[model samples]
Target: MRIVACLNGDRRPGAHPALPVSADQLAADARAVVAAGATWLHVHPRDSRGGQALEPQVVTPLLAKLRAAVPGVPISVTTGLSAEPDPWRRYDLVQRWGALPDAATVDLAEPGAVEVARLLADRQVALEARLGTVQAARILTASGLADAFAYVLIGPAEPTVAQALETVTAVEAVLDRAGVALPRLLHGREQTAWPLLDTAIAADRDIRIGLEDTLLAPDGQEAEDNAGLVSQALARIAAHA
Candidate 1:
């Protein structure tokens, strides 16, 4: 099970003081995670004010810095509609991305998921299909895109550990029925993060962690930074291994 380091999400500066907002900060975090055993990297580029931005001008520089910092690590960026509401505009932004990422995520629950998947596939970027519900899994399966996309099964952040496990089981059953044999990356946010990782480790699924998922460590203390989070996750995975 590989560890995908989500360098940052659409998280604001107030989300975590150590959250990487600028390209330089992100690049440094990327290096630290890679050194600590992260097999993949995911990031959400930000504008000057730290808001999520999908335009080429904002994304390219951040991606370039990350690539330079982490050398051959597979880097990906999110194409979530929450970052840009207009579906057509989201498509256009991805099409014009200056420095292409190794892969990009297309939330199956999003509005223009099919079109965005086609666009990314055409550009030769691997697709990481983010499936939140059984319905999302069925939708992607019916779209004839399952064979080409990896899957992300993220449990909700709010639920109790038992509820979260149930959610993961339901999604996994849906994907299994759909015959989704592609790579599966499982994760959760906020309070569910560590428990979900524990579940993923036992299930032998690829897992992701970083400030994007939670601000706290497994011991319930705040993480010093992304590197600390990655380190703790790696140790947990090692214990399981």
Candidate 2:
């Protein structure tokens, strides 16, 4: 099971304030996370004004700096539809940057998601199919485009770990039936984060944890930074291991 730390690029004060906003802060956080048992790093490049923008100019420099900071750690970038509404524009950014990370996670719920996945595959970019629901997981698995799989256990309406696990189990079964061999990364969002982490660790599943998923630690206290979150997650995994 691999633990990946996500460094949110967007730095909204009230919204996930623990996320690293600047490139230097992100590099520092990545180094700490790597030392804290995280073998993979997921990044979202922030604009100068602290907004989530995946411009080639922004991402290229950010990737270069992160690579220099955390050598050999597999890096994944988010192709979040919520980051940008227009699929064409987002596709343009993906094309222009030619800045491929180790992998890219594409949300299955997004518009034109399958098309985007096809494009990513055509470009030889590995894909992490993001499944937030049973339907979405079915759609992704059915499409047969994912090189890897991840389930986002959070939604606007809070769902229980059992519910999320049910979805994951079903998706796993579906993928098995489809003969797909993609590795899975399971995670939760907001207040349900630790519970889901517990679920994944108990099930011996790979996972991702960081400020992007939850600003609060398992103790119900706010995390000071991304490294702190990674440390807490590592502690949990260690105890389970």
Instruction: Pick the lDDT winner.
Output: 1
Once superposed on the true structure, which residue ranges of model 1 sit more than 4 Å away at CA? 151-158
> Backbone collision count in every prediction?
0, 0
TM-score of 2: 0.89
Worst 10 residues of 1 by lDDT: 150-159
Best candidate according to TM-score: 1
Q: Clashing residue pairs in candidate 1, if any? A: none
Question: Worst 10-residue stretch by lDDT in candidate 2?
Answer: 148-157
TM-score of each: 0.96, 0.89
Tens digit of per-residue lDDT, candidate 1, span 12-37: 77788889989999999999999988
lDDT of 2 at 221: 86
